[model samples]
Target: MSSCAKADASSSPALEKAALLGREFSLAWLRAAGVSDPEVAVLFDQVILIPAAQHASARFADPSLPRKIVRTIPWSRARDHHLVLAEAAKQQRLAAEVVAEHFEAAHRFDLARAQWMKAGETSCHAGDYKKALRLISRALAIWPWDEAADDRARVLREMARCATNARLTDEARKAWEELADHARDTGKHDLRADALHQLAILSADPVRAGELLAEASKLATRELGPEEAFRHGLAHVDLLVNRVRVAAAKLAFVAVEEAALKSKNPALQSEMLGWKALIAAMAGEAGDATRFVEEGMQIAITHQLPEQVAFAYKRRANIADYAGQYSLEKHSHNVAIRYCRESQTGEEIVCMGCLSYACFRTGDWKEALDTAREVLGQPDLHPGLRAIAGGVRGMIAAFRGEKASAFRHLDEAIRLQRAEGMVGMEFLTLWALAYWHDCQGEGAKACAIYDEIRTLWRESDDLHDSIPGLLFAGAHYADHGRAVQLADCIDIIGEILRKNDLPEARATLLALGAEQARLEGDHEACDKALREAAALQIKAGLPLEQLWIESRHPRAEDHKGVIALATKLGTKPLLARLKGEDCGDSASGLTPRQCEVLSFLATGLTSKEIGDRMGLSTRTVEMHVSRIFERLNCRTRPEAVALAQARGWIKLP
Candidate 1:
């Protein structure tokens, strides 16, 4: 200002006049330097016009000088000065306004970025990817060129992966597209590779997905260093592993097995090995399944991957349960649960399901009930697990004699199975419902459900192949006097037994044969059958079955044999029943009508002859014999006669 003042003073009058009127020059200069309109207006009022007017007033000693100068200047020049001052004010305002405006814009940008970051984190945490993707889009719009945008883009790509993990295929596709666009725009090679990787996952066309992942792997290998690129290679292997597993689940086992053998990633190789084990188990290759699971276990143990260890355990449990090794099944389930808990994984539901079945098979109903309760509480359980839990509960209720409650649970299980399209499990639920009906003595209803199950089993080709639902159906029919059906079921059971060399099947067949012989009234055949059945029962260590068989044959000759066998078997209850010594209450001393039926049976009279002699329907006579058998702890007329003679209720001549 000192030099400028001296210059103004020493300048020619014409130049000084020009300087005094230099408002246009100042305005143009300030405008060019980015001053805003409002700032220019303020400068006009406080600096330019006011200072000039005050200087003119003080120097001329005339208040009129200000007015004279204002008026004497050409109208065009005056207008130009006013316009220039207004423009300078505008430029000043624009420059100052832009600071806060840009700051607010930047703040909005930061907020959007933070929102996207939170969404991405939440998506990764909760596996809800659609919301994360939408939030990221909003962020990109707000701050497309932000410094942290690349990091956020990377997160968006990861969110896409989460979408694929959650099975949100469509949402994953959208996220992949966005990531691809970002990669293309920003020239981030790693981002490009990641986007392509996700695109591989999102692509419904498996061929296209494979191609994309292959390209991505090659690109990553070329661009990224070894440490950074290893993850991409692993991801590519994981995709192929998942694809193969999906195909295997759809029953393309051979192809999937071949693909799994070709996998390179250690974790994926272990997982595919487990899948191969499951397929082998299903295909009835127990030895192969065991070998595959062992290999997978070794790999998982070496890696210290608890989740993989849990998976291996589960596969082994399934194989054991399928082979009816209840103890081994229980051990495997325990290992699975331990590993799942250690890894903080949610596979406890599967382990609990296995434990429930194993406990049920081993006759530990209380343990089964407790494990089923725990399975029901897990929120992350699959629908199939819900159905299985309900079925286990129904089994517990049935065991406790709560028929109504059991039926309710069975119905709920059926409903869930149908809703989930779990056809295999639906058959199991139906079987339970039929068994419940059989327990309630609703034989007709049970028969109808059993027929449906038989049809389903045959259609699914699952009978005696893997699951044995049909075998139970056969047993149910055999117990209820469907002999022809029982014989057919016997053949099926025999084939399965012969093929598998199962001792349990031999016992079931012997029991069924004994029941058939008893129904035909061939005492010799019945005696032989009962002796053989009891021997097999004893060999199997089935004290209960031995008791049941001994109770079935109670004629004087048969009774002697039964009591001898029961004594040998240490079955006191069966021994008491065979001796006919007032076992428990004795049905309040059989009614007079029962005595009349017993008299005819003692005389070798048929129910028709008894009906003719007593002037009653044959059905009525048969009913009397049934009641007499129930009252006398006997299963046949001869047994009833023997018991009556021992009780002095009838003279057997």
Candidate 2:
């Protein structure tokens, strides 16, 4: 391809040696590889080779030139060039993979194996798992197991590490299996235990993961001290939590705590206590969660455990979330991040994601969006943290009338959470999607997703953290007559509310009751429920939610208050919906019943009097009136009647 390939036979020998040095090489490396003639450097001046980064370096201008040159040389001469290049690379302390390539080209597999193994390890440390796996495979392909048993075992470990980090579960499993067999054969109990633990991490089935963890822990206890086994025990506890087996995870934690106590490890005890708080929070035991956080924080502070202190603060944020203490939740997440930064344990990313959730709950949309964007921008974030960031951004986008962005972010969040086996996290994203659809008046789409969430809630114990948000969504969906199972929402949530005095639970439950009353056409009961719910929400320090609840009635003052609150909070979606900017329907977005209510209101009849005339319940009349206000985008009955009159929907003499 290059003019050098068309060169005479006299120049072919020097070209062949340069080709063996690779397509690119420094003049010094070329000289070390035995093509030291000063004329050889000048030969590359004719554009077959070009200057490279370093002075006196040249790379073939045409990629195919090196292969073409190699083809003209005999394998015997090429082998000599390879040997020289390999020795030269080693003397210069080049990259292991580079030296390995040369040795492999020279057909010295024995020498190549160690260099390839070293290259793989370096790649693994660099987080280049794909390259690491390839290099490790090359080393294993020619491994002299009997002669270098220790190296073989170490390479196997590196292989598994690389594969796991790459999320190549099948390859990781295969490597771990081989490592386990080799460890058993060599009577290396520690390696066998580690293999079992790693295999457990790769397993998708929780039961199998638990079994492997148990065996690994037992093996570790038998060979080493109880301290060595504690890691396996804690991992099993985390597995149980991921599986949503909170009760089982709690019991597992007890065993882990016993091991921690036995080992006299304060750090382990602090970590165990932090996990205990998390499990309690997940199970809706807010009091227990708070107590556990306090205990964990005390131990972590006394022991000077930075990581455990971060853990305790993270769990405290969880407890605050469950208790509807939004301010505390935000504060705790900030504190956790501070400690996480000091520890450099990477937990700060998780705290940042949780902080976004807190900001969203507290109606700080700008802060929520900014914090989530920051979390999403970080590289190599854990899937669960990424999912949290995505969910928050999506939900905020939905509220900001960014329909396309809402779906894009929410869909990815759901996918990531599901793939990570984070069912609890998945429900939050699902609720956000369903609520967005509900707000858009897409009843079929809303109900479909709500049904899926309901089914999951029934099948798993993981929905406790999601229930508070679900309650609000269910009420909104019910108001639009798109609710999947109102009775189930009321029953399950009522039972939970009875069991725990969650600060937000009572208000959300009452909001659900208001929706039920609206559906039943009980206008008086609906107003009463909303009033009580709004009062509770206000008392709980959630003015945004309170205004939202008050807006269900849509009185002139209530509409003004909600619009003001939404404006102040930068809740663009809510403000737009209130202003009818997001409404796709015509000005006559009211039903026949709503028009009838507006006609009665035009006559200056009270709800009770209107109900008497229409032969309906008073609350039914009130419900119709609220719908008319919403559909007409009016803040008062007079506004609704005036709008209907102007639109020629209704007229009076």
Candidate 3:
């Protein structure tokens, strides 16, 4: 056995038995410590029993021990029944008030009031709101005039905050209003401002909320503290963002950033950086957004603010998504979710939605669908989230060939987004619906919606997604006789890619250029585009694009090359088809005669000169030229040449 076990065994039975006898244990303890009987009675009454009653729960599981000892008390403090009242207070505070009332009936006002206040504070701390409110109100009825007035104010503030935490909003508001009046009457501007701030957070009307914040901010000047000034500045910025006062918001945010930076407060700086990141994201300034988010993340980590770290991660994820860095987007989302607050369900749901979209971009359809459904199943989900979830579901449905279901869900999403006044979500829903329609071969109908989407993009200046928009427009616009407009859109896409230095987007753009070349019957330009795009995709480990370029290889001479690429890419069925005895899957949508004209055009040969070589009339050659233009959906020679090259019909020198 251990030392404790040995000590227990060797200890005297009589000495141990003293602990079981209530009054004997107390008297023995007093005698052993050399206290006189009269002094023992008085000390037990005033010093020992009162504190023992307060601390009994911490010291023993059996309340009977303390209660039994209390019954044997032969003395009292200011009153005789003090231990009885303490015993009652320990059992149930409200029942103890009867003991206090009895003391009150004997006119011992101080002792009675102390018991009532103790019961109230204890109940309040323990979160028994109803009992706390009742007891605290009763305690307040007998105010101590000799005590400082500040004590009363402090108690009233506690009552107010307790009601607030308990979600009795109206009661909290009333209490705060009373406190505000008292503070104003007493010339306490700080307390008045605090009351107004609480009222602002709870106000239902945006106008009233703004008014309250304004009132509070005027009262809480820079003299308060850097932390308070930072909070007020952020609130002012929020009001500006809500009212769409972008310039004013930016101007207000600068002041906050300067304050935090100068104050050397990492926590405050992190918060300001997060706000800056949000503004940059809204404006489609991806690089700026990324820089701000990263700075915030570093600050949050250095300062050990876990929640701020989470917000920083979320901001980076949003910027990565806007920049089309899908892998980075997913990673940032995971990190954000790892550190997010348990009660911040809405933020978690937003992270989930971002992760799902990231999966979709990286070609993980199954995980994307599952995550999207998880977003939909969240309780108390915002309608803005429903709009986003519906977009994901609609895209998945379209990919699986359920066009009607795709349209139904997307239309409903658009409706909800409009109802919620979520302009950003509304724009995305409309874009998704239009893209789906075009994917279903209704390019004409899709073009009608694209006009609005184009306008939205222009107004929002979100040019990062403009590449996909360019591709969609090229497919639909050329046939609709908007060839000049289509060319201009592609030019803009090229400029954006160059300015942004996005090499990943460059491959997709070059692939699109190949499509335009193929349309212009420039087979060589088309072959050049295919080779460059395939090479870029290969370097990026983008197997899907390499497989696509192999399947659509533009020349007979490039057949073995396509087969070799497929083999290198580990693409089984595609390689098998390319190497098969009957390689009929290599068929182009263009006819043999059109291919011949396209090849001649790629050689810089005029149609009339080609007629002399083929022994056909110039008029017949002109007829073929018109027919080729119609077939390839190109208006100009350059466009026809570019589209044909993208389709892989022409061989490059």
| Candidate 3: 10-residue stretch with minimal lDDT | 11-20
Name model 2 segments beyond 4 Å from true: 1-108, 118-132, 144-147, 160-174, 184-189, 196-224, 341-346, 476-484, 554-557, 576-582, 585-653
Ten consecutive residues with minimal summed lDDT in candidate 1? 54-63
lDDT for model 3 comes to: 0.61
Cα lDDT tens digits, model 3, 443-498, are 45677776766655554434454444454555455434465656665676676575
Best by lDDT: 2
Per-candidate TM equals 0.51, 0.74, 0.50
Query: Which of candidates 2 and 3 is the stronger one according to TM-score?
Result: 2
lDDT of each residue in 1-653, candidate 2, tens digit only: 43654455336667777776767787777777666565475565556667888787888777777787778778887787787888888877789998999899889998898799889889888889989999999999987667678878888888888888898989899999988888889989888888998888777665787888877877776676667778877877777787677777877776677778888888888877788888888777887888878998999899888999998888888888767788999999999999999999987988999899899888777888899999999987887888889998997776565778999999999887766667767777787787677555454576678778777776566635556555656664564454447767777677667756665678878888887887777878978888888788877777656755764553434466677787887565456444533123222445556667777788889999999999999999988877666654457876566544433345554
Candidate 3 similarity to native, TM-score: 0.50
Candidate maximizing TM-score: 2
| Model 1 lDDT, residue 418, Cα | 57
- Where does candidate 3 stray beyond 4 Å? 1-252, 255-266, 278-291, 341-346, 416-428, 479-481, 534-653
Q: What's the lDDT of the predicted structure labeled candidate 1?
A: 0.60
What is the per-residue lDDT of model 1 for residues 427-470, given as tens digits with 9 covering 90 to 100? 66776677566544455677788788766544443322222344
